[model samples]
Target: MNQEFYHELGHVVLHIGNQRQMTDSFRRYKESKANHFMYHACVPTFMI
Candidate 1:
């Protein structure tokens, strides 16, 4: 889906090379943030 694509893109934009060095917990945390970024990036405030 588009949302998942953007979420993964978020990781590329913000995390990039840092991901390989992350712990499982931290990776999950960052993934959550990336999802949040995708939601905000794709959704408009008027639609919320």
Candidate 2:
């Protein structure tokens, strides 16, 4: 529904883990993936 919800959903869909124990680069990478997913989730291709 909201951007925050999709962002969190991205993490779930991507199977991302806790960032507390992740390296900086790895954390950024995961965050990037989640962000990408968020965008797609927020605006589905079917709607486009």
Candidate 3:
């Protein structure tokens, strides 16, 4: 179950960087936003 959650989270994080509005410029990209959110949310990366 934990592995499943990690897999899903990775997908969400990767997709955020590909969003049309967010992909306009690399500097303004939100690619790391999801990662930061997950870290703060206590989503352990060890499981990933």
Cα lDDT of model 1 by residue, 1-48, tens digit: 889899988888877557678799999988898999898888967998
lDDT of 1: 0.86
lDDT of each: 0.86, 0.83, 0.52
Pairs that collide, model 1: none
**Can you give the lDDT of residue 27 in candidate 2?**
84
By lDDT, the best candidate is: 1
Model 3 TM-score is 0.33
Over 1-48, each residue of candidate 2 has an lDDT whose tens digit, in order, gives 577898888888886567898899998888888899888878867899
Better of 1 and 3 by TM-score: 1
Best by TM-score: 2
Which candidate, 2 or 3, would have the higher lDDT against the true structure?
2
Model 3 lDDT on a 0 to 1 scale: 0.52
Task: List candidate 1 segments past 4 Å from native.
Answer: 18-20, 45-48
The TM-scores of all predictions, comma-separated, are 0.70, 0.76, 0.33
